[model samples]
Target chain A: MNKDSISKMITIHGVNGISLLNSENEALLSNIKDQQISEAFVFLSSVMPDLEALLAMGAVKQVMLKGAGQQNLSTFAHKKNTLCIQSDPLLSATLLGQQIRSAIG
Target chain B: MKSILTNTISLKDDEDSYLFHEGECLEFSSTKEQADQLSEVALFFDQFFSALRDSDLLYTESHIEVDHALIIANILKNGHILLTITNTAPHAHSNLQHKRPIIQTPRSLVSNKTPSKPLDKKPTALSESAQLAIKKILINYLGPASTIIFNDVYSKWGALEQPTEKSRANLLKLLAEELYTQDEKIKFQAKAEVILKKY
Candidate 1:
């Protein structure tokens, strides 16, 4: 990957089966909105219990869980430098996007 | 008993206008008129009384000594009406003054279900996983931040003391403020207050 390309993009991995795309064409992680994550988990767990296993396979650079709820999984991601965005999903995404864009520019 | 019909009923400024009785809230809202018309006010009271009568809920009205009765009466005097009614009961009178209302109804008319008994002891059983998760979450999120100095915030918040409508409102308000924006917090608080007032 070229340095310019790397500088212009960031990938967000959403634990608990959420995904969203950013402007740089980089694969944004799970698009689940914050308020919907709990309800989403209820559905996802019924289908498959191991969401973390599924997320680990993706090229998500950072993991953002909704709310302070992420404190449960922070230890798991600490080794990977998988920055945990503490705000609710939407607020985290917006803030993350701004931070990423600023870093790239 | 000579039940004196006082012209002005003193009501606290912050007191809820409508009281809930059974499963219904006896409230009146005027649409076009700046205030309720005397006839409209009379009709509203009539409906409330009629509902109680229809339900065979025997109640008695007693004079209350309130400081703001004249003030509230003035508000009602100018075309506004006083809408008061009863609310659901587990079958016993509650110590909460706002929760209990006086009406001219027979005691037998009330529901037969015994009022919920107060718990004798505080809940001490906590799921091991839940306790661990709470501790971990607190240490990770709030402990490091140190923005708040709470020794046992969760434990304190989780406890219930004489669960009244006012207490419930306070709990909900605290939760909303912590989790939501100012507007959302206000909306949540308002919704809780509405529910508490009704039943």
Candidate 2:
């Protein structure tokens, strides 16, 4: 995705920031620079492959983490990269996942 | 707790489901036809919880939507992670399918009984009555797994030939650490202190 589309996504209500990280966990394109979020994404990326193989389910498409407050992080698999969306608590993670899937298609 | 799981199913209006804690199946209905699916999802959740715990994050809940179902994991009051799955039609909209589940089997089927050990070998410093009382209090905070965890901690605490006040306090500290938050730990310690005083 281009910078324009990525910028548009952040403007959506409840969306705070967006980042795209490659397999190596290096940010290919990221608007947010929080180290904790980056570290979480990297950890997720490292374990997701093994988790998929052990679970015997198809590749995991999306994961959403909700903190005790209004902080939420949702991750989606996009081609060879991972799209990490930081959003306010009101955003429906499932709906966000679906929207990203449709956009990528 | 069966009631908690039942309440969740009612609230979600969903299909057959099970609850898991640390990769172990804590409870499930007998009519479950999705054992394989549930097991795979549970294993995935075990790893997910571990990742979050290791990160020292403040996450209270998590969601993973894969294949045709949504798996939701919540951190329980006892600092344990519990996961439940809700089935949905493939490619369906965000609205979840609300099929009423079959009647759940009695929890007795799954067995919560702790294996009995020889009384002679057990620790006597902690009286039997006190042990039972402490276990009862734990049930409120730790739920069904209280018996197992209580028995485990009791073994160590009982090993002392003449338990000092400091050692007794240490035992309570260990149990309190199992609670989810500082507030919970404080509350549990207060209640536990009341019972231990008589012993």
Candidate 3:
């Protein structure tokens, strides 16, 4: 595995309780249940409006919510060229972190 | 994926075994040979239903089975559990009163028993073994940072206590966290929860 690549960063957006992990599979941020898609987009747009620029600045990728069926959000993700992963509510935060790391690497 | 070794058979000649899943029909067979393949299938039913019960997926096993295939298909379609048995006979019959679907294997029998009260909708926490399994999966598959979120969500919802509105809320909260996080750990955990909830 490439150590430098492993250290890359990723942004995850969803409700507050969602687990967002960095490329290294580290828990970099998490949102509460009340946080919605609009809030996530606003946050991302404000912080990293230019996805390519963000990637150049050590951002490896972005993971967004695709809901349970992964039907609607998946299409949107594909259009935006973003990675969308679906998850259940009962999962632990740490597991999400590891998944991010593995996905990025 | 781990390969699990399960016991297939445990009966001698003339020994009879009966298999029943909460609401499913009873499978009965007099001789082990008479119910060989069917018994193995019945075992699968028992195991599958047992897992569902253990996970608190389905409250009562009251649904009657029309055949072994129906039971197997139901479980596979639902993806909740797996069952297997040594030997059994397949006996089909009809109930005159309610006209319910019934399947009677030689190893067991089915009756016209009414289902009990509906079970609570919430999912409790994971058992010690289940919790450990989750931990192992996280450590091995997810990384250290991801574990934190998983632990937080699990601590919040993964209880085996009585299912209630509060428990469901906690579970949903955990799921929302996983969706936002986009972590595999959360994904698998969420899948497990979904299975538990479905059953």
DockQ in order: 0.01, 0.28, 0.01
Candidate 1 displacement at residue B69 in angstroms: 58
Retained true contacts (fraction), each candidate: 0.00, 0.61, 0.00
Considering the two chains of model 3, state its CAPRI-style docking category. Answer: incorrect
Top DockQ prediction, candidate number? 2
Q: What fraction of native interface contacts does model 1 preserve?
A: 0.00
TM of chain B, each: 0.22, 0.40, 0.26
Structural similarity to truth (TM-score) of each candidate: 0.19, 0.60, 0.22
- Over B1-199, each residue of candidate 2 has an lDDT whose tens digit, in order, gives 4355676555345544566554344556434334424444454554455445555656767777778767677767654445666656653434434345544533444466332221222355555445555655665666434545665676666664356654677778878877788987898888878888976
Better of 1 and 3 by lDDT: 3
Query: Could you tell me which 10 consecutive residues in candidate 3 chain A have the lowest summed lDDT?
Result: A70-79
Best candidate (score: TM-score): 2
TM-score of chain A of each: 0.25, 0.85, 0.27
Mind giving the per-residue lDDT tens digits that candidate 3 earns over B64-128? 11212112112433432223221222432222223321223432332544322222223334432
